[model samples]
Structures are given as structure tokens and as C-alpha cells.
Target: LVVFLFKQALTWIFGLLVVEKNLISYPYRLFFKKANKANFSFEYFIYPGLCALFSLYYPKNKSNLLKTLHFFISTSVIVIFEIIAVKYTKLIKYKKWTWYWSFITIWITDYVTHAFHKWFFKTKFHE
Candidate 1:
């Protein structure tokens, strides 16, 4: 639950920013009909779940380069999927957003969340 909450917190923060600023949007979603096209459900659940999974499986003791590579690959795949979705589906519509913006944001989000996860667990467990 903590993992889910942590990721959702980050998601809400970043997700609200882009949506409220009109940088990106989701015209179709399962819930939150009044938040414009922000897709708050995705931010609050699906994405946070995925990010929590990433954190849970992350190799906390690995070298920095390997960890960086993992983040790059994970975020790049997401960006590629976003590009394909943008081309083939109505899942997301970018106003001033681009692929790089998604990549950067995803990377930073993962990095920040995972770093916190590591520190939190390190201090609280196996001591």
C-alpha cells in the first residue's frame, strides 16, 4: 500500500501539472469525468501500479551505470509506446508535449520515487 501511495503521490503531482497546464491530455478514460481530459484514474492507479512494480523489482545494490541503463530502457519503452499510441490511438494527445518530454519526466519520476523507496527501506528495514 505504501508503494502504491508513494507512486500515486508523484503521479498526481506531475500528472496534474501537465493536464492543468494543457501540455498533454487523455480524451478517453475510465473515470474522473470532471478533470477535463486528464485521465486521473490512470494517474491514480494504473501508472502508479506500474511504477511501484518497477520500484519493487529494482536492484538497489547495483552499480549506478546499470541502474541508469535500467531506467533508460524502461522509460524509453514507455515513450515508444506513447509515440505509437499517439499515432494509432486516442489515448493521449500532446499539445505542447513531445516524446522527449515524456522520456525526461518518466525518468525523473522513476529516479525520484525509486531513490526514496531505497532510502525508506534502507533506514526502516534489515538494520
Candidate 2:
């Protein structure tokens, strides 16, 4: 839940900036059509849920190479699907954005959230 919320907060800020900058758009949002330009569903729910999964399943004891591979594969899957959505769907549109932006942002956010998760659960306390 911590990871999910962290991702959600990051997305809310960055996603709004991307939309406000005309870098990307969502033509078919389920909510927040007037209050914001970003895709609420994706930024608020979908991406955060995915981040939770990423943090939960992350291999903490793995080698550096394996950890890097995990990040690469997870980020690549989202970028590949996003490319397809851009090509065939009206869910997301790229104005000044590209697949690399999504890839980089996702990778960075996931890395940050993973680091947060580690620091968060690193020690136990009782009151």
C-alpha cells in the first residue's frame, strides 16, 4: 500500500505536468474530465496497482544484474502495451511524448518506489 500510494502521488504530479505540457492526452477518461487533464484511472489506479505488484514481487536478495533485468522487463512490458495503445486506441495519445519518455519515467518511478519500500520495511518497531 505504501508503494502504491507513493506511485500514485508521483503519477498525479508528473502525469498532470505531462498533460498540461501537451506532451500526452487522454481522450477517454472515466473520471476527472474537467478538474484535470491527466488520465485519472491510469494515473490513480492502474499504474499504482502495477507498482504495488512490482514492489511486492521485487527480488531483494537477487544479484545486481538480475535486479536490473527485472526492472528492464517490467518497464518494457508497459512501454510495449502503451505503444500498441497509441497506435490503435484513443485511450492515450502522444502529442510531444514518445515511448522512451514512458519507459524512462516508469523505470525511475519504480526504482524510487523500490528504494522507498526497502527503507520503509528495513526495520521493525513495537509500540
Candidate 3:
């Protein structure tokens, strides 16, 4: 799926940039012997996969309440998982970042990506 692929790539770019900037770190990662702090599993796969599904099924031309509710629900799920991961699995370690920061980033990224996806569909790959 182009949507999934694009979202996956975008997530990796943003996630890696965050790691490189030292805003966040991943002490535990997958598909690598040494942790690189990029969160390959989550960024390259999990989160984008979730995004793909969400985008595919997200209601269109919906009421503002529905859209807001959707965003809040998705953000809450992610934040809860992140909290657990940070506390129990030690998967993520925040240096200059905070949980609220992650929340806002996720919220903004989702909306922007969704907008791009809609535009791409409308343009039929012309852009």
C-alpha cells in the first residue's frame, strides 16, 4: 500500500531525526544487535502500520466531534503504550523530550500525514 509505505518512511525520517538530535533515545530496539536509539520496530513498522490502518478506515467528511474524538482516542492509546514501554520495557528513554511532547508530536504528525494522504489521493499521483 502506498499509504502505508509513505507513512512508514515518514515515521522513520522523523523518528531517526529525533534520535539523532538526542531529544529521545531507545535503549531497546529490534532487528539490531546494538540499540541505535531509532526504535526501528516502532517507527519503521508498528506506528506506521497503525497509521495506515487508521487512515484507511478514518471517517471522512465527518463531524468535528467525531474527528476530535478519533484524534483523542488514538493519542491516548499511543501515550498509554508509551508510558508502559518507558516504565516497564525501558524501550524509550527521554532526555530532552517529555511524554507531553510525544503526545503533541504524534497528534500533529497524524493530522499532517492524513492531509497529505488526502491530497495525494485527490491528485492521483500528479503531485
lDDT for model 2 comes to 0.91
Candidate 2, residues 14-44, lDDT tens digits: the string is 9989999999989988897899999998889
Which regions in candidate 1 have their CA more than 4 angstroms from the true location? Answer: 124-127
Please report the candidate that would top TM-score against the real structure: 2
- What are the Cα lDDT values of the candidates? 0.82, 0.91, 0.82
TM-score of 2: 0.94
Report per-prediction Cα RMSD to one decimal. Answer: 2.5, 2.7, 2.7
**Candidate 3 lDDT, tens digit per residue, 1-127?**
7667877778878888899999988876657637566877788778888888778878788998998888888878998899888788778887898889889988888888888888878845553
* Candidate 2 positional error at 3, Å: 0.6
Pairwise TM-score winner, candidates 2 and 3: 2
